[model samples]
Target: MPIDHFHKFLTSAQQEEITLEAAHARLTHFAGRPWLFFPEFSAYVTSFVNAMRNPVAVAPVDASLPLSQYFIKSSHNTYLTGNQFSSKSSIDAYILPLLAGCRSVEIDVLDYKNEPYVYHGYTFTSRIPFKLVLQVIRKYAFVTSDFPLTLSLETHCKAPQQIKMAQYMRDVLGELLVTESLDAEVMDLPSPEQLSRRILIKNKAAAAHDPNSTRPLPDAERHHSAQSSSDGTNSSMPEAKGGPSSSILSKKVKFVSDLAQLNVYHQGSRLPKLPRSSDSPDLGPFQPHFDQIFSLPENKLASYQNDFDRLVRITSTNIIRTFPKYTRVFSGNYNPLSFWAVGSQMVALNYQSFDFHTQMNQALFHPGNRAGYLLKPD
Candidate 1:
């Protein structure tokens, strides 16, 4: 038989095995026979031997679905069952229902300096270290067999504390740690440098009002530098225009400009660490005293003053429209019980929260929909 036909027959045969010894005898017997003209059966036999010696393991990627549906809100107490490190059974009992619906879990971690613990406040009564909780989770939590379930870790430690304890656990167990909490009003990512610059600008503006800080410029009055054009609008808003001498009064105007920029934010940023008094009316717009800064051409001064006035008006309008959302969430005047009750009902209904979790999940799994969320400055 041709080698091709014989190979095909071997493949088609069911439960038929030719031992190595028997196969070698058959090959030897066939060798040098006139009917078999094959010269390189050795290579074929070697290929077969290698194929039989080593086989690869194949796993299907499509066998599983993502566990994104499972999530935990950090405000309330929630726990996972049968976590490798968590040994608690009762906490897992409370967490079982949430686990069935979701693949990830969350818990709040407050710092306990020397030990792996969880707590809040200055009192010992509030302490609940993570070490104790994980011990129970590992004991009773039923982790998904195929997919690694994530523990959504949240830290409530103060900003200055650089304790590496939690980071250590996150590294070893490969869980997600959410260090920053989203505020009622969304703000840009915290950058210490940006914060410092803003503080410096505010300080400089305050210092300009001090006689001892810097001498008043010698020439506060000067001829109008900005000439009125056919349109009659001062073009100096974006650049230096006819005001007091650009050299002398420019520094003072710039200082005021920096102060105005720093104070441009809504109540929260502008205020000196206090809630707005209920009786006080909103300041309508920024009012920079142009008369102090410049003696401009009549038409040009009006135009420049109007530009400054309009910018403040627009900014305040934006704040008035958007600042309420944050006030509701952050004002602490909210009744916690009422908020909790509503949230509980929504969770019972499996209603998705339109904010953080939804956005975060979308960002992680559905990258295409990621975008920004902004609210007026608080």
Candidate 2:
């Protein structure tokens, strides 16, 4: 059936309101927890939930909802864009709407001659200076919001200049900056916020550059590659397909410790830190914040179970891979089938607003156009 017809049936059946309530209840259970909204792709899930048979109620998007703030790139045209659509104007428009409720925003920091610059890689030249971007961010930061607009910057390379660029942002944005971990599961993922805080240095290899050296950060076993340069930096050289290091494991442990320290130092109180188990490596990274929030004394056992179950469901590999653009767009006899399955799905949904649809199309169709952000079109 056409999705539009399905939506109409949902509205006509009064099932729409019921499903929204169900979704809201699920969201409330997850309140105060960190959640990511890939603005471009989340609309699909929104539409799915809206069309589902469940009597869940989904709330309209509100900035102040209990969600721990997350960040995304400037690929979407936010309210700040002011209507005219050019690449630069597109980015200029999002600052305010994002600042409205976001606790943190991602900035991709590039190092140019030992200084940090804030433009995404796709817009300007590869070697654009960091100061130039900073000037623009300052000029366009016209957002008015109560909460401080925190920054979560990512460094594109292991280059020493990444560190220096981060320091510059701290100097400017001050305590609102949060240096995101580069070992963010995938390596060298684009982060714009790194321009505003210290870029997270993972292995000894990344540390060798000294863009802005800190207390010797611990080596996390999660090396991009084992091969090291004479300067102790991890080489971009690919590894020969073995597992990560024991020291790297310890480094991850230490990294968690640093995160705790940062929360305490910046956020005032330290969040709960769960003890690492001797049990299983299959359990992956443990988020102490989730543990703390769910463990609150008054929370219902049912609520905890519901949230945990949904969390597991959302984090599954299948759910993430469901994004059409994330999968390779194969070209063959089967290409027609793939296009219908993926491309048509993207075109079928009805968003709450036309602005949202426009922004999403930019992300779905032109992901490679953003600097600092990389989408594998392959």
C-alpha-based local distance difference test score of model 2: 0.28
Regions more than 4 Å wrong, model 2? 1-104, 119-129, 135-142, 175-378
Assess each prediction's global lDDT (C-alpha) against the native.
0.27, 0.28
Cα distance off (Å), candidate 1, residue 60: 13
TM for candidate 1 is 0.24
In angstroms, give how far residue 251 of model 2 lies from its true place: 19
> For model 1, how does the per-residue alpha-carbon lDDT over 48-117 read when each residue is reduced to its tens digit?
2224443333232221211111111211224322221222323433233222222234443444665544
Question: Tens digits of per-residue lDDT for model 2 on 293-320?
Answer: 1111111222333233333322221101
Which portions of model 1 show Cα errors greater than 4 Å? 1-76, 79-101, 119-126, 138-145, 158-162, 167-378
- TM-score of model 2 vs. true structure: 0.33
Candidate 1 weakest ten by summed lDDT: 196-205
The local distance difference test score of model 1 is: 0.27
